[model samples]
Target: MLLKPGRGFFFAIVLSSVAPVAGATALAVDPMTVLIREYSRGNGSYEYLNSGTDESYARYILDRPSSPYANIKWSLLPSPDTPTRRAIESVSTQEHPVNLRDLHDMKVWDLGFTKAHIASETFRMPQELRYVPGAWSIVKAGIEPDIYAQAIRNQGLEHPAMTANYALAAQLLRAKLAATPPSLWKIRGLRHDVLDRFVGGEFMLAHDFHYLIQFLDGALATWDAGSTSAYGFRQLPAPLRLGRIAAAYRQRLPFEHEPCMEDDTHDPEHAGEGTFDRRPLCFDDATDRAIHVWYAHELVQELAAIHDRANGAPTLAERMAAPLRSSRQGWIGIPRPSAIAEVTRIEVVEAKVTGQLLVEGDVSYRDAFGASRRALRLSCGMRP
Candidate 1:
């Protein structure tokens, strides 16, 4: 019987690292049977296992410790009768199996898959959906600035491995930023589409993954813009548990962009086949909403830092120079599009516990058109 579409109903699951089960029946049996046996034995928790090619299994892994089957374990054998073996057989028949190995040798700019996947008539899986995280993606996941901030606010101390991951991600991001002709990075502008180029061209996975990637890319972009050095960002988190939770969820955390609207609206099982409506997009989804809130809090903290630094200067010259100094040497590390000549005034309109902050101010800056003063209004997830 086809299981009802739930967190994990096998559409396709990719299994890697199949370990040998110690003792099991030689006869072929369904995976559900093993699941039942374990449940019957009253094991409250079991090891997580990967098998199959369907998204039910993929989404199950995407949900992680939050999923009902989070603790369950099932192993696959060389025998073709196993569910995992069947999935491998199934994927082998598909014209486009979600494999990154095939695309590795291709240059990021020359990648044809991004346009191809977007233009395809039928839905195809993106690389972010893979249960086993790609080496490129694992490195990309650790470079998140907000993740570092979250680590600071909630915990102070990163796992050695996570620190290593973040450090690697920073190094790669810097290399990518530096190697990129200034023109291309400007063209990319820190968006989801950059994943196609930046993280190794793979199919667009989930909108949530794209959303998070945008944030990380933006952070690195600031580094490129001379806001702060990589070493400076590391200094802030060196004492905090920045990557401890991430360490527990390593590899998994990077691809956990599930519960995204793309799955809800586009997947045949969830939204009904051929009903393809992109209108119910990421911004409307619950998970993305929470992420937005987190980003909002981070923004408030950033703006608050700017306000405190600029307003605290004892004299007008210092006050006017405060923003520029902060931009160059401050801890907040946000990027500025143009150099600030002076911050004339700052008024905090509102600050809320819900992670919303509103501030409006008069600012003077020189750009290509020359210097001018204007009122700048800043709000989390809002403008004007």
Candidate 2:
């Protein structure tokens, strides 16, 4: 039942749903793109960049600017080697545009690349390992088996790449669960360390993830999707209201809107066309302090911009090499998002496709300079 190269509804591919739990290579078509789509359209992975799509360029090495919890991992990674980063910035030779293919030398993990090779054969080698929020989201969702068996209860609505991260993480965990045991989650090591990283954090919506897992697990216990037997399922976590989180941060930052709302969505009808205009906006409260809170849609756009710029290569590198002289404002290099859409249609196509993902009912944060949030769609394809 695993999706074949030319079968199944495009992005509707899910591991456990595709077939009986027999093996990790259950599906014929790779599940990389499908997993990214789950985290909202904004996220792209290391696998994606190396992909043939023109959108599969460099910059989004870690596209978590929209997610509040993204920076934790980015900051933890070794800073892009200053000399190498400087060389990349210097850009003496523009022969190679530094696409994913050009990143073979990036074997060691840096702020912009994964430590594991992109083409490594290890099952542990992930297609997309750059985004922390997405990675943590997937790991959290897969903490227990039943959590995934009863998946309907989990409406992974927020965090730019969080849901996508959950999808990939869940898939790998499923593979692990197939041969190993659910108790592996309890054992100490990579899995347990990841659990502690996210769950231990008091403010990264840890309880939301916990309740989501519990709710899904409980729902699975019952056959009906509408009804649940456990009391824990009845007490679901409150919705992820984008406005309130923004308002709380607004209190500290100098957003055009004062004392931003505690709970609200984007108003596509009347919104500014800038990075700060989105729900999961990031701005430093004070110097050297950056805070990012990503909405489901905002991160989608944020990730695209990051990738496009990185793909552009040496041109961007030269700009990065430019020094900041006097009155300093952090370099705001987010390119205009390619697709400000309403609906996204994911397909595994040739490299010609790469655009922003659009989610319906969710407000479009950018202005209508050349943007419209109509029945819009973007596709991230892979050429195999």
Candidate 3:
């Protein structure tokens, strides 16, 4: 059922006795253990997960050996949150019941995020959290769905914000799938291509470009007119040249030293204390290379068009502007091979979010073959 604002407190009380699934053979250790280990190490605080009133309840719920998989019976409850809730309620009341297997390939999927709030607050790392060597292998082999279902059942839809967040996630995933390449054969150099194809011909490399554009557009739409900074103009790709010209207009100029108060709010303990440290935003150099390569290809097409012109007497300006007839032929700018050659090494740091899946970690790429480089931290929610 879709949750509604101001009704979460009562809904939580109605579904308190639901049991978690048991007998998951794919996972060596439970999901809660992994989340605790990562959070404790990153925050450098022991009691954050282990020694609280929340920890006692978590141990009671998660430590038991039982199968937590059960279709949520939203029909028995007195009040459902939305009209969508009535639809799910009707389905649950059927004589022939639906199961998790039925939802595997379903297009309209909703994964409630309120589960994270409960897991983050209650779960403690087991004493053997660090000793589970085969943990990741098990998760990758497809054991996360059950763990996720268990968490969702445990946290029942209590907040409308949770439903809204999940709806956004569903939209993003659908968009990504729709833009995916139909087949690997259509994409050049399947052997050399670093990006993976999914459904259409659009490369994964182009996904981040669209995200950056959206970010800039949203900021500009909501920006204050009195502010001194240029809003929409900042969407232009960072300059390739490392000279004074590039440094003068870099995007970092706007928020380089500014405190990342927004990101710190994720942690409630350090909310007002300002204890969380903000890392520098590292722009992807590979994106710059792709942009330049696109430009160089356009230049070649323009040169060919000039040679095809029959009169052969047009001024240089007209010949130079011939490619502007097609947006695809727009100037990409000069090719910069140095940027491609700058990347040195890429390392992945794995962090567990809810004990079910190991989300994306920090990916550090050294530039100039170790001469100089930068690091970028990514979240699992961010598509690769």
Q: How much lDDT does each candidate structure score?
A: 0.25, 0.24, 0.23
Show where candidate 3 strays beyond 4 Å: 5-76, 81-86, 89-192, 196-384
Kindly list the per-residue Cα lDDT of model 1 for residues 274-334, writing each as its tens digit: 1123121121111211112222233233344433343452432223223323322122224
Cα RMSD of predicted structure 3: 24.2
Q: Tell me the TM-score of each prediction against the true structure.
A: 0.22, 0.21, 0.20
> How do these models rank on TM-score, best leading?
1, 2, 3
Model 3 gets an lDDT of 0.23
RMSD each, Å = 22.7, 22.9, 24.2
Q: State which candidate, 1 or 3, has the greater lDDT.
A: 1
Model 3: per-residue Cα lDDT over 172-252, one tens digit each = 233233456656433521211211221222332433323323322222122111111011111111111111111111222
lDDT of 2 by residue, 214-318 (tens): 332322222111111111111111111111222222223244643213222223333232335544332211000111122323433433333224454433212
Residue 291 local lDDT, model 2:
19
If ranked by lDDT, best first, what sequence of candidates would result? 1, 2, 3
> After superposition, which runs of candidate 2 have C-alpha atoms over 4 Å from their true positions?
1-190, 200-254, 259-297, 304-384
Where does model 1 exceed 4 Å of error? 1-72, 75-172, 178-384
Report the poorest 10 consecutive residues by lDDT, candidate 2: 324-333
